[model samples]
Target: TLFVPEGIDDPEIEPGYVERAFATASRMTPFWTEKSRQAHDIQVRSGTFAVTMDGAPIFGPLPGVPGLFVNIGYDGHGVMCSIEGARRLADLMAGDAEHDPKDPFAAERFLDGSNPIPEPMTIHQVQ
Candidate 1:
């Protein structure tokens, strides 16, 4: 049940979103039975977020801001990588020696001219 309100920057959940959600679910999946929909209690949640230029995470220290580390722009995989990502960022902040030299998620890539080519936007790849 992915509800992506396109071009919406407002963090507040809009009115009638629950109805639209159920409708989209039903339309996209045959498994969303009437019984299931009727038995469900809908609760809406919303927030604002930013996406990186290349649709990948921007982790580690922010350039020109000493001691300010960031771990943002995970696209939609924050839940999947939160634990590992946090550990990596913490290690880097603590001056640990085990940090990867070629860290792919480094924030400097945006400024260092090493950013990967941006992918073509699609419905499933919205960022």
Candidate 2:
């Protein structure tokens, strides 16, 4: 659930990123005390910080690639919106629903000019 905003091109995690994560955790939580500075059973995940021009996630079939669907472009809200996108994508793939350009999160919105300008992002940070 760590949602760091920085981007990296390669899979190699920078040592400083870990350092900064520890620093942030220690600052933001009482549980991350000096006694528990070390972490065990770490898991790694890597993915592109994909963003669309309209600042919304895409969930549906690929425009031309048959038998392929995409659930992407969460921008920075993947932590919050991923589950909803998965549900919608499943419905679309199963023929339970159709792509609706009217929905801002729809993948077809880009093709139909329904979503052109980016939506304003609501980013908040703890001091």
Candidate 3:
């Protein structure tokens, strides 16, 4: 996966960029040979999205709103984490489990004087 920097204009599904990435990737590992890269069919898709102020997800109720809850900001790993996130958010909303307002993943973290220092965006820091 390419870590396109934040301010650059969006290429918006540029095939040349994808091909170049595959070419570079092929050179990095024996498993991704030139022929293998060429043979693999590639499909491209695109979207606009937002990441959170801090990298971690925001889960649980919206502050001061009794019936609303939010479970967002998974960065790019929403598919991997959404099941547990939804379960935990449901537990909070259903009152089936104790809900901690100060829980690390809680939305209140941004407002309750508990916001953590934002981490640098790096490949090693992902997840």
Question: What would the per-residue lDDT of candidate 3 be over residues 13-118, giving only the tens digit for each residue?
Answer: 7658676766787879767675654665666656644456677788888889888889888877788888899999888878898778778887877885654666
Q: Positional deviation of 59 in candidate 1, in angstroms?
A: 1.5
RMSD of each: 6.2, 6.7, 6.6
| Comparing 1 and 3 on TM-score, the stronger one | 3
Quality of model 2 by C-alpha lDDT:
0.73
Candidate 3 yields a Cα-based lDDT of 0.73
CA error at residue 7 for candidate 3, angstroms:
19
TM-score preference between candidates 1 and 2, better one: 1
lDDT tens readout by residue for model 1, 55-80? 77877877788888888886676788
What's the lDDT for residue 41 in model 3?
67
Model-by-model lDDT, in order?
Answer: 0.70, 0.73, 0.73
| Cα shift from native, residue 22, model 1 (Å) | 3.2
lDDT of 2 by residue, 1-127 (tens): 5566644443666556655777788888867767346676666555557888877788787777788888898888899999988988999889999877567675667776553776666432335
- Rank by TM-score, highest first: 3, 1, 2
The CA lDDT at 73 in model 3 is 86
- Model 1: residues with Cα > 4 Å off, grouped in runs: 1-20, 27-29, 39-43, 98-102, 112-116, 119-127
RMSD of 2: 6.7
